[model samples]
Structures are given as structure tokens and as C-alpha cells.
Target: MQRKAPARGFEQAEFQARTQKAQALMAQQGLEGLLLMTEPDVRYFSGFHTLFWQSPTRPWFLFIPASGKPVAVIPEIGAALMRQTWIEDIRSWSAPAPQDDGISLLHELLAPLARRGARLGILKGHETSLRMPLGDWERLVRALPGLQLTDATGLIQGLRMVKSAAEIEKLAHICTIGSATFDQVPKQISQGMPLEEVFRAFRREALAQGADDTPYLVGGAGPGGYADVISPPSRRPLQAGDILMLDTGATWDGYFCDFDRNFAIETADDAARRAYDVLWRATEAGLAAAQPGNSCQDLFQAMQGVIAELDDQSGDIGRLGHGLGMQLTEQPSHADFDCTRLQEGMVLTLEPSLGYGDGLIMVHEENIVIRADGAELLTRRAPPELPVI
Candidate 1:
């Protein structure tokens, strides 16, 4: 007989905690149930990440009622994978060909609660099920015309904002893999190496170090080139005076770690060296603002203050940092305009960029988790100044 495959990294306690939090939110919103269909949210609540998402022919539906255990109404192809986890109750239908594949399954699972006058909470913005016709969802709503449907994305966003202990460990492991990969890039990026060669070398190193894939990888090299935010590496060979920006990250298991450092090829230029120091200070200022009870706006302001003090041209076109979770870039990005509060257990990236002159810009980014004391650095490596060649 063949042996069963081992379970993925899963913690029952974490699931229960999340469920309890959701239940509280449901009570506050007066929602009878929440209908989660987004891939990340589904995997988060159900602890199942199946490859069946590639088939747009069918959508996976997970119904988390205000009370009791959650039930997943998924395609038959994904049912087996769901069984591998602690989620025992699952209902599935065949496919597009079946008379009533996903539509029928969803109605059957929700009909009883709808009859009980249950209000359905949906993340309409991210719901892929509504893509085609939404005819099935409409029919189900009509079946129980009294049932109410409202947006419940806030409940999910709240739970995900606070990282659990297990999640932090996974994120830390991801950072370790990323840092290890970056540590080796110096040897490969010499004065004469092509930009593509540097890019390929980093990709290979990251994968070999256990990264499943990279979500972000864009960098460039030029004596005074930094015009575009993210462009493909060019065929031009890296020269001694080139200032290169390598901002990249890779996913390990499922968590993602992002870190970017500026490097000066072979010979260090005065402008590049000064830009690096300013960005380094700005990054540190941003990290310093990440503490319990602080506002995200304050964090960006801290970096903004440093950048403005250094160069009048410094401005934040993007968020100072964003919350990182299962799907890499999530929420809580520290925008100079946002008013969100900083809380403990939140993992964010402290990256502040400064653009000056034509094709001259500097950026330094790192990851950290908010703690009671202060910011806890996840990516422990020091920022690079010049290429090690």
C-alpha cells in the first residue's frame, strides 16, 4: 500500500484563534455568515492551498458561518487537498460540464442558513466568482430573497493585519533565505558583468536557497541612470562608475521577504555614496517609527523628515512600508496620507526612496515586525554600499 503524504505546516490553534476573531467581527457587523472566495482569504481561513485555482471554469467557495465550524464548497478536483488539513467538512461539484457544478454546490451549502434569515458577507471587490455572469449567485439570492448580502472584507483584513507567532517564524525563515541569496550577489556582479547576468545569478541563488518563487525582481545599472521605477536589465555591461539598484524578494514555502540595497560598481562615486547614506538614514528613521501605538503616518513622516532634510527633491511616490503576510504584499502600507495605527505583531517593509537629478535615485528597504518594545528586524543583513568586486 502507498503511504499518505505528510501534512503541510498547519496549526489548529492558529485556525481557532482566527475563527474566534472572525466570530466577534461577525457579531459586531450583525452578519450571519461570511462568504470568502478570494484565493488568499480562502487558504488563510481554510488552511488549504490547492492548485485548482488555475481553472477559471469553476470557483472555490468557503462559507464561514457566524457560529459553528466553516464549510468549504469547492470543485471536486480540489476536494482531496482540502481533506489533507483539519477542515473535515467539504462539499464539491464536478465542473463546467456538469448540469450544476459550482452553482448548485454553493446553493446547497448556503440554503439552510439563508432560510434562517442569515446575512451573507462578501468581498465584492476581490470576488472572482462574480466575474462571468454572477447569474448563479443571483439565483441563489433569489432562492432566499430575504437573505442580505454585504461587504465583509474588513473582517478578513483585520485578522490578517495581526500576524500570529507561527506566521512570524515563516516570514523570518523567508528573510533568511533572501538575505543568504543577496550575500552571494557581490561575487557575480563584477565591473564587466552584464545586468542580465546579475539578474539571472540572483534568481538561481534564491531558488537554490529554498525560495519557491520571486514576486518582485527589478534592478538596473548606469553611471547616472535611475529614471524608471522598474525596467528590464539592459545589455550594457556594468561599468566601474555604475550605480546599481537591486531591489528583489522571493517567496519561501508561502511567505515572502523583500529587501533592496543600492550598490556602486567597481568604483564608488561621490553622488552614489551620499545617496546611499541619506537613504540608509531614511530607512532607519522609518524603522524607528514602527512601534506599538504609533501611527503609520508617523512612520512615513519620520522617513519623509529625514529625506527632506537631506534633499529637497525627496518625495514618497509609494508607501514607506506595507504589511506582509501569506500573499506577499497585503495592506497597512505606511502612506504619508493614511491614518492607520501601528500595532504589535504587524510585519512591514521600511523602504524609503529618494530620486534626484536625471537618472539619479537611491532606495534602501528592509523588513521589520512591530513589537511592544520597538521594531524587530527580520532581514538582519547590513545594507550594501559598493559592489564587492
Candidate 2:
């Protein structure tokens, strides 16, 4: 199936509604303001997209008030780009200022709430972190001692868990691009090809297929099955009986589509073929179980039941799958510990893996969105049987 790329960026109304919803949640929690420092959070509210986040020399900030639009307290260099967003109040400073480093600006913006003993929320729970320097963070904390700093991991992750119609469009577009790239793997490489070159070829194909970037591409090739799923590509050459996997998190615009495919180099062994069959059937179970009413645990159990037939222990990787969006992985993890219920408009990856044959593991993944009725695949489904190159 072919899909034309959706329009880049988002409409002003998209950000406006997002901000309104965040504000409503903030008001319910008695949060005076929600402070964000990470790239995804800042980009979620204000469409301030840039690769400048790669540099650690400066820090950026966004403050979401309980009533109106969010404020962008950022470096002087980003002022022009931030201005293009729907944001109204864009505060700027000469960043990397050893003396102030935007702390003074943050203090002034948050000081009023300090006087009234108002609560402020920063993401402080699991899967969250402060992207700024620790010394600078301590300085800001010391400056605003009166402000009640609370953990807002739940509040923010909750708001971002479900994707909007516009967001889903971008997601679907990227997934299409990734799928097209994956389909070209057999033509790109075969036995005697170096694994590292295979990785390079994948990046080139993804970019040629319309992906903005393939920042996350890792897999391993080995006899029968791979040692593990997360190993970086080695310089070793592919050979007969080797199982090759390439898991990619290709991006278009700022959205990401994470999935992987497995191909047998020349031919596959009996053990590897059986493992692939189990994983494929497991994914089929996952596709059927992924519904609006199913919980993440329910989804996990459905796939786990199929995987357990061959291997009781799923791979070392903690969760089967996770929420997908701006970043590679998001909240509402598919695992026993996570009971987050599935809802319409929530996008996720159903990854099922199994261990077989003297510590070798095989993992299969696919991207999908939860519709009112069931799961709709974003990435093209892998073949039932592993392909031989």
C-alpha cells in the first residue's frame, strides 16, 4: 500500500487544543505551571523543531500555565524559530551564561508563584529526566525554594499517550516509508556482505524512501539465530544458516516508526524456522488481541501465551512493546506491571520475542494504531515464513 506524505508541521489549532487540554489537566491537579526542559515535551506544545537539541551547550524551556498559551524560555539563537510557532511569549537569553544560564529568567517567571506557595510540576517519575546541567538545576532550585516542586510524570505522559488525528497521519506516513525501505533489504544485500555495510545500506534506502532520518538502526547476524536483539552491527560477513535482523526507528518530520524484520541468509536451520513461526503466530495473536477495550497487560498476555508454547521466558527485554510517537518509545508499556488500558487513537508496537537453541533469540515487531474496533497496522506485516536471501 502506498501513502503520500502528510503536510509537515501542524496547524495552529493543533497546538492550541493541546495546550488547552494540558491546562485543563494542570488546573485539576492544582498545578500553577508546568515546566518542560526536554525536547519532545517542548516540541509537543510549541512546534519549535530543530536539531540544535543535539548540542548540550545550551538548554531550552517551556512553561505551560493553567489558563493560556505556553511560554518559551529559550536561548537567543532559537528565538527566530520559536517565533514561528503558535507560542506568544518567547523569552530569550544569552545561553551558556556561566553567571546566569537562564536561571535568572526562570526565577523571575516562577518567583511570583514562590511568594504564594503555589505548586509547580516538572517530570520527575520513571522514563523522565532533566535535560539541563545538574549545577544549573541546583541553582534554579535554590533560587526558587518557596515553590512547591512536584512530580508530573503521570500528568504529562497521560496527555501524550493518545495520538491525535494529525499525529496519527504523520506516524502512518513514516511507518509507510520504513516498510518500503525494509522491503528492499533482499535486493540490497546477501551472503558475503559485511554487516556494517548492511546497516549503511539500510540508512541510505530509508532516506531514499522519504525518511528524514534513521537515527536508530541496530541488529545482529549469526548462525541459526542472533545472540541478542540490541547488538550493534559487526564487520562480520553474512553466511548461510545466519539469521539477520534489522530493527529500525525511522523518522519523518518529528514522528518515529519503530519495527524490525528478519531474513535468513541463504537458508535457515530447523530451530530458527520454528522460532520464527512461534514469533509470527505470537504477533498474529497480538494483532487480534489489540483492541480498544484490551489493557496493555491483556495485550501482553495474549502474545505471551503464544510465545510460552515454545519458550516460557520471553527475552531479557523487560516489556513486550510500548507506546510510540515523538520519541522511539513512550508510556503505557505492554507488560505485566503496566495495566494502562488501551483506548481509541493510541499507537503502539507489538513486539514478541522468544529464546531458542542454546541462548539464541528471535524478536518480531510491527507498528499499529488502536482504532475504535481493532488494531490497524501502520507498517507492512512481515511474511508468515522467514525469507531466504
Best by lDDT: 2
lDDT of 1 by residue, 51-112 (tens): 56656787777888888778888777788888986787898877664456577767777787
Question: All models: lDDT?
Answer: 0.76, 0.92
Clashing pairs in 1: none
Residues 1-389, candidate 2: write the lDDT tens digits. Answer: 45577999999999998989888888888999999999999999999999999999998999998788898899999999999999989999987787787888999999999989999999999999898889989988888879999888998999899999999999999999999999999999989999999999999999999999999998999999898888888899999989999999999999999999999999998988999999999999999999998899999999999999898463657778999999999998999888898999999999998888788889999999999989999999999999999
* Candidate 2 residue pairs that clash: none
Q: Distance (Å) between predicted and true CA of 388, model 2?
A: 0.9
How well does each candidate superpose onto the true structure, as a TM-score?
0.90, 0.98
C-alpha positional error of residue 288 in candidate 2 after TM-score superposition, expressed in Å? 1.5
Q: Count of backbone clashes for each model?
A: 0, 0
RMSD of each: 4.2, 1.2
